[model samples]
Target: MQLLFAAPARKPLQVDRHLRRQIVRYLTTCFEILSPAAEELIPDELEQWGQLRIGNGGDEIHARGYHKLRPDGRDAAFVRYELMVDQEADNPSVDERLEPESQYGELQHIFVLTIPPKTPKVNPHRKKKRHLLLAQIYEAPFKFDEADKYKVIWYKGKLGTGEVVDALTIQCVIDAGEYLYPYIPMFDSIL
Candidate 1:
């Protein structure tokens, strides 16, 4: 006897509430460390910063990048949260030049929250899930060898846990850098 059966229907992707809350906490801590005063002054901007959304499959987190000054009050950085597939080239390229190399006195930081790709549910009884890989925080500095005017200087896997502690530590480091060497004009500042 032959048996006939229909394939199981695919379920819609649901937002991970736990991960969402973690992201919110992470961003909150970052902003508080980076610019506590600005939060109250620019509530709208901070609200926008906390907004997170799901992106189309294939490694892209649909979220707006937030810009704020470092604790030193001179330097600035752009913080972004993204859900990305494990595949290479999915993350935004830092190769493009945001501004001229000669116009900057300091490098601008690009802090990113990277969510690794979801594992495929190979078994019928199993379910796919996503998790935070690491927070990639890098500096966009000037370089002459490449086509683009800027080069990326990674912070050696800083904020790898995507937790408040890491965020605060990174903030302090950034502030210290600024204090020791004041008046470092970033590319964003020039633009």
Candidate 2:
């Protein structure tokens, strides 16, 4: 009867130049911040792992699947989050060390990595357990309007990918009822 169980589903790991750069940046930034876990990971090891489980947890600890990233403080994943991407601020005009500052990017996926407790005991430390998060993300480069500082211009496109972000990310931002946008490429005025 055990054979009846389905094999864990996995998508092909397609890391293009942009994604690769992002991964490298993520790793480098993590290391600079003194993250011990980040220190262990090298780019060469990504191919070593067969799969990176998404959507649901693979272990008993994080088996409760799918938390809606809402503003209600229910889930760790936020819809429109300013993801801390960079470790340093861009030329801070104030008294600050020439160091990394919290920078934000667009959030793509939230991986809640379940780490078993040391010494084989149930870990009592559950203070914001979901905060143990790894996020797949992207950032749009922005330029303030020359004449009108109030207006901002930024780059946002698939950059060749079929979809810019997961549909769930969009769904979370929408109202309680149904809402719809044009298919693929639409709207003459916007673009």
Candidate 3:
């Protein structure tokens, strides 16, 4: 005789409003400051705030803004803002670095804000998502060799068949700027 068992239903993840608002505010402010010249060209109909489904099969709060326009009156480049909230307490440390894999394809700009786990919990058997949040904002062309900047990691490899592999990893760890401080009060309250 064969026995049948029913699988348990999964519950939807809860949305944290405070964290979401912080992420939106940060992204909006950055867009306004970074690309002031192209701001007027962006279409007003685009989504200012909404939920974006990331590659990891999870929905994150996102704010989208256009920054550039093409000669034909079309949007050329836009910025995407993402917020990743870590609920698992036993997760690893929060890395301020941004990886290429974390970004969507060919976006002109991508900003991710990660909220660390509120409390430490034990969960050794489960796997966690790999995501990094913004820790600092730096002006372009800034020298990495500066005293405050962190060192970048370079990885090179070759396949047995003589194929070469090239990769570069950069980690950012600077103090969050004044614009980001407003969100801190909300983050502290939630924790």
- The best candidate by lDDT is 2
When 1 and 2 are scored with TM-score, the better candidate is: 2
Candidate 1 clash pair list: 59-85, 106-185
Give per-residue CA lDDT, model 1, range 1-191, as digits (tens): 11111221132222244334444555454334333322222211111121121222211111112334434454323332222223433456544333212211111211223322331221122343322222223332322223456532222212232222222122112211232332332222111
Models ranked on TM-score = 2, 1, 3
| Candidate 3, poorest ten consecutive residues by summed lDDT | 159-168
Cα deviation of 42 in candidate 2 (Å)? 4.5
**On a 0 to 100 scale, what is the lDDT of residue 135 in model 1?**
27
Reference-based lDDT, residue 28, model 2: 48
| Comparison by lDDT, 2 against 3, better one | 2
CA displacement after TM-score superposition, residue 113 of candidate 2 (Å): 9.1
State the lDDT of candidate 2 residue by residue for 29-137, as single tens digits: 5334333443333232122111122233321111112223444533222122223333345656745345422221333443332333331122335442311234454
The lDDT of each candidate is: 0.27, 0.30, 0.24
Screening candidate 3 with a backbone cut-off below 3 angstroms (N, C-alpha, C), the clashing residue pairs are none
lDDT per residue as tens, model 3, 61-83: 22122223334442212111223
